[model samples]
Target: MSWSGLLQCTAVEKNGRTVISDCYYEGALKLTRPVYLHPSQPTIYLIHVGGGYVDGDRYKTEIMLQEGAHLIATTQSATKIYKTVKVPVQQYTSAYLDDQSVLEFFPDPVIAYEKAQFYQEMTVYMKESSTFIYGDIITPGWSESGELFRYDWIRSKLKIYYEDNLKLFDHLYLETSTGMTGIFQMEGYTHFGSLFVISPFMTQDLLQKFESMAARFPASVHLGWSIPMIPGLVIRVLAHETHAIETIFQMIHQFIREECFQEEPIFLRKY
Candidate 1:
């Protein structure tokens, strides 16, 4: 597929700190200046200059980290997918993490408007000693009729490979034509959030922490989490509003940062 925008960036450990060593971007995709919120870790925000994705648009991204490097990546704002006339907007991202590195990717939610179609896929390659954390949320966009789930469909796929072997593969397809509120579907929930954490720190004790967190939420929100075959943790949530899911995800992220990485729970500084 011909991409309308392309973004490539590399981070390396230099002088005991991680920094963006190389960056190349064109078309609609760009990145903000690297912000060092925590001395050793750099946070980068991905931006889409086009404001929103349109039909027949394709975007590609590549992120690489050298050995002993750690980086945090996030988006400037929610990804908006507008109504399509011919085809769905597409995006593909590939990330590579070297030995003993860490990559925390936390992007904003995706809003699919009425008659909108969006397809996204991401793949991560890492060594056994590296750590990877990714989080995403999907919410319906506004419509004139104020109807929920008015969009056409959304297809999202994520694949993780560790030590050159596939550790996790998750594919989610939600189609309005197939009924999103019935059994086995979203069950009337208007928002979906997913979090994946792959690191040696994901242990049985971590599961207990997540269990306690789930117990705090009300019945309006549903939280489901599990430990995959690999040494990782996966959590999924269904809620009526975006804040309900984001609050829980942020809590877990903060815990992992302070406990596992032994760093302060800092903010991304969205405001």
Candidate 2:
């Protein structure tokens, strides 16, 4: 494994269309070419040549968006963290967004296999007018005994700043030491997902609309959203299956695309 792997990219607006101004990557982390599913927004996929992360691996991703540039990024597939005896697999991500820019990151779930330990830290610096949407799922990997929560632990810390002021600081940590089966822990749930949106377009009216929409979903999925904190909101979901949470997030994503961006729902076109 490489000691330190990096995937850095910068995007800028040119003639009303966003384009990659610069990109550099090495080791296991690589980026696919930008695909313009939408004329203005480019979708880029992050690829892991090794297919999965293992012990003592370290990765970093840095993204820069010039004024008015918009980008959508996702992984080619689910991120799998395998068994580890020593150092935990680590990933660090940072992004800078200029005025009126946007970034949408909707990666697939991360599965931690038996005895795995993983850690992630992400930070974003953006103007109040800039928009950011990020969502992901965390799932327990399969084990020989068919026991869930076989992984050692998983942790992630996220920090969002608006023009030098910290707007949100979220920390999620779960360890088997605390009994993952406990009520405060996984609580018999098999998966957990989160969606975070910080945009000028999120208003109280939209929040109400989403609340009503989420309530209509079937009882199999458990999901809730925070009240709009003016420019930011959070949604947490727990479900027995991955598709249940994914369906809910997809509807919300479609709403944002149509109502706020005046565009059709994005199709990643993974094929």
Candidate 3:
């Protein structure tokens, strides 16, 4: 059936600290109480009480960060897409960042069950001085029948705008039943991941540093970096185990935190 959920979070500076002034949710979506891990940054967790997305299920979230505000948004767990007959599971997120704001959207991976169809779209509108980091990981769902890549299809799009000008638009689509060459084929990898870093801080030297960092990963894990056709840095990975990609993500996040903010990365405790 048709189901939709909405969540909105607005942050503003108060008393020398950035705080979530208004937080609200409706329908199957929910949010934990905002946590202040640092003075300028507040952390929020996205929760889906329905457990997983099914056919015709829709969920949306919007985040507004005022000038100089900082926020970290993550999910309590991985988003699961169950089997579907015809309809698809859709989700959307829109974020608006004022001047000099910072946002980190780092959620767990999505596992698509057999015959499942999933779609996700994310849009970010921000000033030229804002900093945003977004990531997505997908893994083949486990099947008792011992079959992999049985899902019908999965599609995702991420678009970012700088002061009304489109700066980045990334789209991806994978179909398991189409017999398409190299669609989900990465030397037998079962999972894939992509990370986007959008900020004025990205320089050629920093991109080279990231390339050097990828060299330390095992040969089994294929790591590639490319300067996106847009105005950002993109890193892609193909791995047999999901944890391998996650470990590298942690390293990159840590490096960004230290280099940009001179602070340690927030280790979110998953309950």
Best by lDDT: 1
Poorest 10 consecutive residues by lDDT, candidate 1: 210-219
lDDT of 1: 0.91
Best by TM-score: 1
Better model by TM-score, 1 or 3? 1
Over 86-131, each residue of candidate 1 has an lDDT whose tens digit, in order, gives 9899999999999989999999899999999999999999998899
TM-score of each: 0.96, 0.96, 0.93
User: What local distance difference test score does each model get?
Assistant: 0.91, 0.88, 0.84
RMSD of every candidate to native, in Å, equals: 1.3, 1.6, 2.0
By how many angstroms RMSD does model 2 differ from the true structure?
Answer: 1.6
Q: lDDT tens digits, residues 6-36, model 3?
A: 8998988777678889988999889988887
Candidate 2: Cα lDDT at 210? 76
Please rank every candidate by TM-score, starting with the best.
Answer: 1, 2, 3
Clashing pairs for model 3 are none
Q: Is candidate 1 or candidate 2 better by lDDT?
A: 1
